[model samples]
Target: MVSVKSLHGSAQLLLDVAGGVTRIAERTHRTIVREINPLNRLRDIAGVPSKEREGQTYRFIQSTMSSLQQGLHRSLDGFSADDEPTHSVHSEKVAAALNGVCGDHLEASNNPLAITMHFRNSQGAKLRPDSSSMGATFPNAGPRIVVLVHGLCLSHEYWKGHNEADLGIELQRAHGFTPLYLNYNTGRHISSNGRELSEQLQILVDTWPVNVEELLLIGHSMGGLVIRSACWYGSEPKLPWTQLVKKALYLGSPHHGAALAKAGHLLTFVMHKFRYASPFALAQHTSAGIKDLRYGNLLDDDWEGIDQDEFHLDIRKPVPLLAGTRHYFLAATIGDHPTDFSSTLVGDLLVRLDSAKGHHSDALKKLRIRPEDCRVFEKLNHLALLDNKVVHDQIVEWLV
Candidate 1:
């Protein structure tokens, strides 16, 4: 008995209802958790009755109370990690802890802040593109600039400082390349930030008054995917390589897609159902999330971030970046359990060899990608690829 227009109207109303329900549900759940957390803490302090008691009746009551307390804690805590801080410190503090950058700012910055530094300042951000005074320098006389991008849920701190020269110092010393680390929020959708990153890079190139002889790019984990996405948008045959990028190197880049991101997608499903998940819940199933794991988003515009219907990065899809740009790729991986299932619990306490490689390599092959790439090392985790002296030396030999 319903006409087409009525059906359309009904659909729209249903959509609105669903949206309202989800938003209210999430907020109410969060609030209830906030209120009950203190109660549970007090219960802990007061000493919940022990399961093992002196009398028979006392033992039954104690055991029941213990079970109740456990349930209460689970209900209140939800998916939040035990002992995790409710509030985050300032960005400066995060930066210092991650890389020792801005001490004073760390005291002022707060959580959910973009993990990455803005190469452009507040004033520059406000100015017209033509009027902005932001500086971008690519000096021919001094060292070459190498920008390092970090992976998901991580800061540049992921670049361990153990190996001689580390990745940055080694690249600088061996190739006369200066290292620049780029940090950004991993929580946002990948392409949204990637397009932003492309513009940021363009702005950077414009501000640099120096004549850049060459530009070398490096990325870790999700950072690898961002560089790829950036190149996809920015590269063109008409553009002169000399005017912009020269070479890009991906360490543990997920060229196809990542396995961990697939797990994240699954987790997002569970979290959404339970309504007690972190904002990171979206991080798991988003298109950007899938892309970071090595699944390519070739067929659709994934920025909208819809669920299973969303397109992923097609690993085997022909890359859009120009061929002559001297692009190099390296892969890293770990075990299979958390390895294939969770990016959080992968190999070497960091990345699985498979995730690192974006391909299955039993021995954790370290190889150069492009024009018949070479595998230099056989066994190293994602972090080791950056922090290990051997990897740095290998990179130097190739660049030189």
Candidate 2:
């Protein structure tokens, strides 16, 4: 739901974006102008007499625009001081997309548009960590608890599979496993989200309606990385939720790293090295969460205080699979067969097969999973992992 505060936050964000784009365009114009304008070059040789005057004009214009923006922000604040209107599904999708791009900035700036992590049911109602609340949400609550986490730029709403049947619904109907969907901002650092999830799971387990016999976690894409991060933190503190976890499944997860994110990092690095491309590089401001996918960072030390724009060696700390929990790595390929070259080069069109299977060139980084635990589905892309019937059947079979 979109709140009044969200609208205010959106206005502020739009103003910030406009200002950033204006600055980038201005710099690019200045760079091109300096190279092409003989008069400007001559002025540069004669100590830049015109640039100072141009700078003054630019500053004046910027001041005027800033003042106008502030006025608009204040007006928006006053207009929606008390009312919050619910928006359509399209708006929610847009919000999710925005969170994926700059969620860290929105959070750091205290923007109400930033998404807060929470648990929800199949119907999209918020789930609370208490016996009565759990009973109310799930009257058929069972001992087996299933936690489903969605991927980047997605929500719990995206889990609908064939015949509009989501994994949660099928798990409950088939195996009496009560399911909880984790809804969170995909733009924050994976380690940060993982730590919070560990804490939240602790509370949920402590206050569950039924005695939890076993807990199973299923994550798709970036969600798998978040699950790994959470498991690492939970085990580090010996959290009770970690002990309850029976199996953790990674569906098309980039355990080692994602190829697209690596390509993006390389592109940004290359652009940063050149003068003309530097300003454009500023336009590629990605969230910390997106940056973490470069080498699948799961710890704070991997990224904190480091220059994100520069290319660096993969210094990610090795995190092993959760002890006493069965782990499954499910990968997919656009190829029709496993032996096809496309399967190796473009696993699911976003993650490579080796990465999804937790295979690393370095032995220290590879996940310790049995050969039988890894499965691949051919002729399927990354997004198809969410909705395909065969994928659902495979997951169910594994759980069974």
How many backbone clashes does every candidate have? 38, 0
TM-score for each candidate, following the candidate numbering: 0.55, 0.89
lDDT of 2 by residue, 99-187 (tens): 88898988986666788999987777777777788878877777889899988888787787546769888888878888889988889
Instruction: After superposing candidate 1 on the true structure, give the runs of residues whose Cα lies further than 4 Å from its correct spot.
Output: 1-112, 115-143, 236-244, 267-300, 308-318, 333-372
Worst 10 residues of 1 by lDDT: 99-108
Specify the highest-TM-score model's number. 2
- lDDT by residue (1-400, candidate 1, tens digit) is 3333223323433343344445455455544554678864465467865332134643455455456545544554343333333322243334334322221121232221224444322111222233134233222324256777776655554564454345766677677875666766654445645666677666655555455567677887667767766766666423333245677777766554555556656566666665345433544323234433435442226434444523333333344544556766664444333335443345444444444444433222222345444342444566567676666666777787
What lDDT would candidate 2 get against the real structure? 0.84
